[model samples]
Target: MAELAFCLPDLPDVRDFATAQAVQSGMSEEALADFLVAVNEVATNAVTHGHPTAKAVLRMWSVGRVLVVEIHDEGRWTPETPPGQTPPAPHATSGMGLWVARMVSSDIRFETGAAGTFITMSFKV
Candidate 1:
C-alpha cells in the first residue's frame, strides 16, 4: 500500500497533485490526463462551493489493485439535487463538477455537514 497526503490552498495545487500522482504512479500519458481531469473537477468543486478559506487534505493509498483518493475540506456544504436526476438548468453548473468526477473515477463517496465535507474517489489503477 502507498499513501500520500497534501493540504492545498487552491486550484493550482490541485493540478500539481494530479501531475505528481501520475508521475509517481508511472501511469500512461492517457491515464494521467484522466487523473488530471478528475482531480480538477473535484478540487474545483471543493474550493468554489464547499470552502474558500478552508484547507483540503488529499490522501491517496492503494487497496489491493485499486487506487483510492480522499479529499477532506473544512467548509460548510449546501444541499444540492440528488444524484442520477436532472437538476434544474440554473443549477446545471453545480452538477457538472460531480458529473465529470463520476466519468473518470471508478467510485466516489461523499459526506457533508455544517462543519465540513469529505469526498473519496477511487480509480482502478
Candidate 2:
C-alpha cells in the first residue's frame, strides 16, 4: 500500500498524486475517473468539516482486480449516517460530496471515534 499524509493546503496535490498512483496501479480509464471524483469528495470533506487544523491521511493499494483507497483525518466530526445514505433535499447543494463518493465507489466503509474519522473506499479495477 502507498500512503499520503497531508494538510489542507495539500488537498489538490494529493488528488493528483492519488490519481497518478491509481493509473500506475492499472485502474481502467472509466474507473480512474470515478475514483478521482470519489477521492476528491472525501478528501475535501476531511479538510472542510473536520476539526480545525486537522490533517488527512490517504492510503491506497490494489488487491487482484480491486483497488482500495482509504482517507482518514484526525478530527472528532461524526456523521449521523454513513455519508450518502440519505439524500439531501432537492434544493440542498453543499452536502452531496459523500453521496457522490458513495455512488462512484464500489464499496465504502466508515469509522469514527475520539481519535478521528476514517473512510475506506473500494473500486473494481
Question: Which candidate number has the best lDDT?
Answer: 2
* Best candidate (score: TM-score): 2
Candidate lDDT values, in order: 0.67, 0.85
**lDDT tens readout by residue for model 1, 1-125:** 33333344556766776677656655567777777777777776666665666566677776765677777777755557543234336646456666677778888887888658877888876
Worst 10 residues of 2 by lDDT: 74-83
| Candidate 1 pairs with clashing backbones | none
lDDT string, candidate 2, 1-125, tens digits: 89988877898898888988888888888777778888988998888877677678899998888888889888765567666887667988788888889888889998989878889999887
Native-to-model Cα distance after best TM-score fit, residue 21 in candidate 1, in Å: 2.0
Residue 39, candidate 1: Cα error in Å is 0.8
The superposed Cα distance between candidate 2 and the true structure at residue 81, in angstroms, equals: 2.7
Spell out the clash pairs found in candidate 2. none
Clash number by candidate, in order: 0, 0
Over 4 Å off, model 1: 1-9, 78-94
Q: What's the C-alpha lDDT at position 82 in model 1?
A: 41
